[model samples]
Target: MRVKCTVSYDGTGFSGFQIQPGQRTVQGEIERGLKKLHKGQEVKVFASGRTDAGVHAIGQVLHFDTEIYIPESRWPNALNSLLPEDVAIQAAAFIEEDFHARYHVRAKEYRYKVSRSEVRDVFSRNYAYHYPYKLDYVKMREAIKFLIGTHDFTSFCSAKTDKEDRIRTLYDIEFYEEDDVLTFRFVGDGFLYNMVRILVGTLINAGRGVLDPYRIPDILKARDRSLCGKTAPGSGLYLWKVYYDN
Candidate 1:
């Protein structure tokens, strides 16, 4: 049997989602929990996407092939009992044998948070980008308008990315502020390495008057990493959701 699991985690304590030798990671922890349940049986879990270090996820989807037939109602309790507090299994159910968490993904949503305040809150320092500059929300929104729809996002990706096709369809990009918290939300078909962080950095630059709102079109046309702002901190990003068609 194959099982699909929806998980949520605070990534502050882990290296990242993927497992690496001698490094604490989300996959490693989850696999450990599975091992405990299955009497040391190693099961490989597949995730919808790999999040960078210090990045979080509210609805990360993963799947594993297992012969152990446990009731879905007991999955949460069973997994949580063996897993650490930072990682939690929200739901689990039987999935089609051929279903893949990564390949079948239809869309993904990521949000980058910024604390736009004069004084920073120590509690939120781990989850938000603290910027002391006064940001023009209107300008940021205007710049985001240029990001929606399909385009070559080469300029917004890390130079180290090996992806040959830089084209990606961004369903939406929006910014909103509530109190001292500013949220940048992006929904897209897929993202390249460090793509979201770089996008947020560019938007932040636009908000801080460093980049003109109208310059976004030119930036997209350039398709060069030098044309975009630096990649934002990984701590400020979260995998908000993933969508799948059937």
Candidate 2:
């Protein structure tokens, strides 16, 4: 049977979602728990996508094949018993064998938070990016208008991205502020490596008046990575949700 699971995690303690040779990671820990459940038989887990180090997730989804027939409702507790406190299985269900967590994804939503307070909150230090600089939200919104549709996002992704086709669709980009925290929510069909972080950084620059908001179209047209601003820290980013076609 193939079991699909939705998970949430505090990624501060993880190296990343992917398994790495000596570093602790979310996937590594989950697989470890599954290994124990299967009496050492390896269980490979596939995720919708990978999150960078210090990046959190509220609704990350994964799927794995298993011979065990534990009830779906019990699967969460069964797995949680073996997993660490930072990672959790929120829900599980028996899924069609052909369903894939990654390729079948229709869309994904990500959120990045910026703390505009004079003094950083110690409690949220590992979760939010503290930006003390003044920002012009109006300018930021103007800049985001250019990024609200399908386009080649080459200039807004990491140079390390191996995918040659940089095209992706942004369904929407929303910004809101509450209690000194600025949130940028992005809904897209797909994202390249570090794409959201780079976009956030570029938006921040525009908000700071460091770059003209109207120049966003030129930057996108350039398709040059160097034309974008710094990549925002992963701590401020979250895999908010994933969408699928049933």
Candidate 3:
């Protein structure tokens, strides 16, 4: 039987979502938990997206094939008993055999957090980017408009990307502030490696007067990595949600 699971993890201690040869990863931990339930069998799991090291996820979706039978109500507790404190299985259910976590995903939402206060909060150090500069929220919002449709996101993607096609459709990009936190939310069909972080960095530069908001279009047209801002810290990024057609 195939099962779909919704997971949430505090990625502070994880290498990333995908399993590396010898590194600690969210997939490795979950696979171990599954192995505990199904003795002597290797479990394969698929995730909606692969998060970078130190990047967290609140609504990560995944699927796995297993022969062991466990009630959906007991799935969370069963997995939690064998998993680490930072990783939790929020829910699980029987899914169609054809359902795939990655291929079936319709859209994904990512939020980048920035601290606008002069004094940084120690508690939020792992969850937000502490910036001492005063940001112009209006200008940031204006800059985001240029990113709200399909475009060649080559400039925003890291040079290490292996994909040849750089075109991506951004459904929506918005900027808002609440208290001392400035939030940048991006919903897209898909994202390239480090795309969101680079986008946030560029927006930060615009907010800090380092880059003019009106130049956003020109930057996108340039398709040059050097013309964009630095990639924002992974600590400030979160995979907020993933939408599926079915």
Q: What is the C-alpha RMSD of each candidate to the true structure, in Å?
A: 0.9, 0.7, 1.0
Models sorted by lDDT, best on top: 2, 1, 3
Q: Which digits, one per residue and each the tens of the lDDT, describe model 3 over residues 1-246?
A: 989999999989999999998899999999988887888577989999899999999899999998888898888898889999999999998989999999999999999998878888898898999997877777888888888899999999999999999999999998778988988899999999999999999998888889999998998999998899999999999998999987
TM-scores, in order shown? 0.97, 0.98, 0.97
Q: CA lDDT of 88 in candidate 3?
A: 94
Whose lDDT is higher: candidate 2's or candidate 3's?
Answer: 2
Clashing pairs in 2: none
Off by over 4 Å in 2: none
Error of 3 at 50 (Å): 0.8
Q: What lDDT tens digits, residue by residue, belong to model 2 across residues 153-225?
A: 9999999999989999999999899998899999999999999999999999999999898888899999999
Which pairs of residues clash in candidate 1, taking residues 3 or more apart in a chain or in different chains?
Answer: none
Q: What is the C-alpha lDDT of each candidate?
A: 0.92, 0.96, 0.91
Badly placed stretches (over 4 Å) of model 3 are none
TM-score of 3: 0.97
What lDDT score goes with residue 154 in model 1? 90
Which prediction has more favorable TM-score, 2 or 3?
2
User: Which candidate number has the best lDDT?
Assistant: 2
lDDT of 1 at 238: 94
